[model samples]
Target: MAEQTLKEKTAKGLFWGSINGGIQQILNVVFGIFLARLLSPGDYGLIGMLGIFMGVATVLQDSGFSTALINRKGIKHEDYNSVFWFSFSVGLICYVILFFCAPLIADFFGHPELTNLSRVLFLWFLIGSTSIAHSAMMTKKLMVKERTKIEVSAMIASGIVGVVLAYKGYAYWGIAIQTVTNAFVGAVLRWYYVKWRPTFTFALRPLKEMCSFGVKILFTSIFAQINANIFAVLLGRFYKEDQVGYYTQGNKWMNMGYTFIWGMIGNVSLPVLSEVALDVKRQRQVFRKMLRFVSFISFPAMFGLALVAPELIVIGVSDKWLPCVPVMQLLCIWGAVTPINNLYIHVLLSQGKSNIYLYNTIALGVVQLLVVVSMLSLGIYYMVLAFVVVNVLWIFIWHYFVNKYVEISILDVAKDILSFCLISLIVLCITYFVTKLIFNIYMLFIAKVLLATFLYTFVMYLSGSVTFKESFTFLLKRK
Candidate 1:
């Protein structure tokens, strides 16, 4: 019964989180469509170059304290207070370090402008630190419903601020301003929504324990970011900023394909799984349900997007951005594999298995870092191809890890994947014929997407992936 309650709560949280994340993602898509038109790809590339340093600096600020906070049980107000101070202090330290080392960071990326760009962007860490406590506290309390709403509102507000500023020609600062404003708004709103306050004091002893766990997690975070941000780093150093912009645009839309799925899984699943850590039967039920929900939608979206990447980018972004088309397709395929991989991370954390996660992450991170570095010699096309290869490896490693924890069969995973790919094929066929008949890139893109979406949903309904009555009833009342 307690397990069931946790599932229901998780569902509620995911429903709300998805709504919030969905709105925010849509705004991002809208902005990318607009910003891609307004700014040169070189503009995006410059920011992308600095982003590598920024990513490392930001990770240093939190170092897994937040993740450790979530995994640690029975945390008190004092613990929270200590965490707040520790994270804040780390932010200050990181800011100082980044400020001092800005020139070196610029040198690493081989771009002189990266120094000032990085120094200005380093302020984000400070801004980000303010809200870590509030945000983590929300996760600790499984307050996803409130978390989602506040974040969504901040997202919309930030998008508005960014677009207006970009149009005014602040260049990269336009993007930076939006980021800073979004953090400020999100922190204020998250605190307002949660109403938890901390005096900025640290308990020397408990702070040590929190830092111990957090430091390990911090390494994990850095490893993960290194792999994810490599493209931007490599693009900036080797390719033109315009090319970086193309990649950025491609990456943006590719990520959009996963937002709702991520919403339902990562945002909601951890707290849900954590709440019932001891109950294997119930944990499995919740995990499976979450997996099913994510897979159904995410699978088809990425598949269809891959087929139409060329058309989608050409229409949404100008001809200048068309270089992203193939990279987009490669990344869209990468996107499809994430739902299952992400589920493993959440389940591991919930079961007090973060050490396993840390180990797996380290191994994978080393491999990816080397892989990405090796590919830098091969140019951007193969660099994108490296992503596809790494994704395949990731799926294998995750399954290898999960084998001990759950009984998920290879066949089961394959069945879900194959079905999704098949549906994608059906959609592609429809789009191909319709595209041939119509011949307008705009219509082909939109028509293919809509037709794919409709056909996938229809086929899923007919195949009992979900039922009409069940889905409608589920939607009608948020059951």
Candidate 2:
């Protein structure tokens, strides 16, 4: 296959990619409401505790081959078949290992219930392995439009199914069903849109090539997963089960913000940047565009969320999550900077410059744990402060690495950052004043969101940033 232009991939990928993800987010928000009503915070906490290993294992499943397959020019069918077989095998092995190791894992956390939960969730790997390659094929072919359609449908189906089961008193089965069905349905649907299929034929040579790069990627991914999940682990150990659940749910909401914001960047930027894998100059331009794109949206979203954290928790998750309000407030910092930080991280990885990014992430992960430990050592209020500070460190550390390699220019990033800050400041101030009239939590929050959105769009228009009218209409009109 001939290499496509970066603009073509970026235009197609980011636009439809964001739509696919945006559709998923809308469904999740609705589903979250239902699930919160169905299950208590302790249930979610139980799962979160068990999920630390599963999360790390999920990251390891990628084996970096997805990046390799996407970035390497002229990848062949044979190479993919080999990669697919490798993933299929590793996934099976992972499930088996985790199945037996479940009790030990739960023991490590000193939670007996987690044993069964971990074992039950490990079954997802078996399901995941059965459909490993088709999704990769879809991405390789740049089928973003079709991909999004299936993804949206799958998310809707998964959410509805999970909510119904939870309503029927399935307990963690609700969570379990949603997790597995999402993989089961999405993978099956991907095969329908994708053009390639892997066969039984596999070769050691191709596996070796893929694994060589994947080893680095795999360990880096593990480090990242462990780092991200550490807080959940710590929460379970140092705090009450209810506290863990609240924090877990809080992070889930924060992930809603983080995922939607970063999902736009990741789905768009990674593949787009991969096409220009050899050209640092063009890569830098693309990176800046994404950074600014994120700032234009993420800054305001995070600011507004923080402004209404209390109400959001109270109403969004119901009173079961009141304990999470503080954690939600703290993690909002991570949410706001998520786009830029993630773009730079993806930029580094797409270029195979994982070591530096890995270093920063690992160092920060350690720092994060230390901060959490220190804060927990002192008290809960200080722990929240530690959480926020760790995220701040994450932002600067990523920016520093991005500056070192991408060379997109610090001033360029600062300009985007400064503008977003100013925009958020003005809009937040307006929201505060308007709340005097619309004092109800829901109404004031809505007022703030709508007003701030209009103001941000207006400022973006004045700055000649990507405007709605110019948003690649091909995505919407392709029917």
Please report the candidate that would top lDDT against the real structure. Answer: 1
- Backbone clashes per model, in order? 0, 0
Determine which window of 10 residues in candidate 1 has minimal summed lDDT: 465-474
lDDT of 2 by residue, 1-479 (tens): 34355566666677776777777778888999889878988888888887777777666666777766766667788888887777778787888889899888777767788777777777766677655566666676777888788878888888988999999998877898788888788777877777678887878876677665666777777777887777778778777777778888888887887777776656667777776667888778767767777776687887777777777777777876787877887787778876677787778777777667657777877787787787777756577678677776677777777776667666787876777778787878877787768767788778767786787677767777553334535556554
Query: Could you give candidate 1's per-residue lDDT for residues 184-227 as a string of tens digits?
Result: 78878977887778875657776677776677677877878887
Candidate 1's TM-score reads 0.93
Clashing pairs in 2: none
Q: Residue 149 deviation, candidate 2, in Å? A: 2.3
Candidates in order, TM-scores: namely 0.93, 0.92
